[model samples]
Target: MATITSASLPRPATRGEAKLFAEFRAFWRAFVAKAFNPYRPELHYMRGPGPAWRAKHVGLSPAVQSMLAEIRTGKARRSSPSA
Candidate 1:
């Protein structure tokens, strides 16, 4: 018996990517439900982030902090040109 191996065996999806995909699917389902039932509580939930989400990642690298400040004050439109 001979064993064969291909040069390009597809890489398995990482756990993080799979989890993200699951979250995205849930969001999609919620969105569709909201579309058909505008007054549903889940509709409001799916609308997006609350204060907690914003507050969780408040700390950032100095470079990122500066860039965020620039954006907040309208000095930049994301992604520094030099970078």
Candidate 2:
């Protein structure tokens, strides 16, 4: 492994070289933006805080919640000898 220093890095001294580096930096930023949402064309430039599906879902939809309610009843059925 080698360490890179700012003094050893190449700096754009000419207008043409500086313009090339600026375009490359812009392209790299856009590439990273698309990588997160490659499929959403409408969301190419706008990203939300979270996934839309999670807005009203938790993998425990109403039906699952109803099915899990029996656990409470089972606990109620096991009293401490009515004491």
Candidate 3:
């Protein structure tokens, strides 16, 4: 078996090398965080009716239009039979 020697052991990093390593480590951590992020803004956003939907549902029946208007005016209420 070969004898271990102090000279053959790894030397401690110098100040500059330590700083560079710290910066690189920080950069790598940030890159990994961004790469693995799961919070998609598009998925969380509240999507409204698009132009195609508007085009497809161009004509609303009078009852539905009145109900929608009531909802828009905050006058629509849930109907529950009185106990």
Candidate 3 regions exceeding 4 Å error are 1-7, 47-83
The C-alpha local distance difference test score for the whole of candidate 2 amounts to 0.76
Clashes of 2: 0
lDDT of 1 by residue, 1-83 (tens): 99998798889889999999999999999998878875756555776677798789566789999988877867554545755
Pick by lDDT: 1 or 2, better one:
1
2 against 3, candidate with superior TM-score: 3
lDDT of 3 by residue, 2-62 (tens): 9976667789999999999999999999999998999888887868988889879889889
User: Residue 37 deviation, candidate 3, in Å?
Assistant: 0.7
lDDT accuracy of residue 33 in candidate 2: 89
User: Highest lDDT, which number?
Assistant: 3
lDDT (Cα, 0-100) at 37 in candidate 1: 73
Superposed Cα deviation of residue 40, candidate 2 (Å): 4.3
Put down candidate 2 lDDT per residue, 1-83, tens digits, no spaces: 99976666677479988899999999999999888855876656756456666656646778777867877767777953675
Residue pairs with backbone atoms closer than 3 Å in model 2 (clashes): none
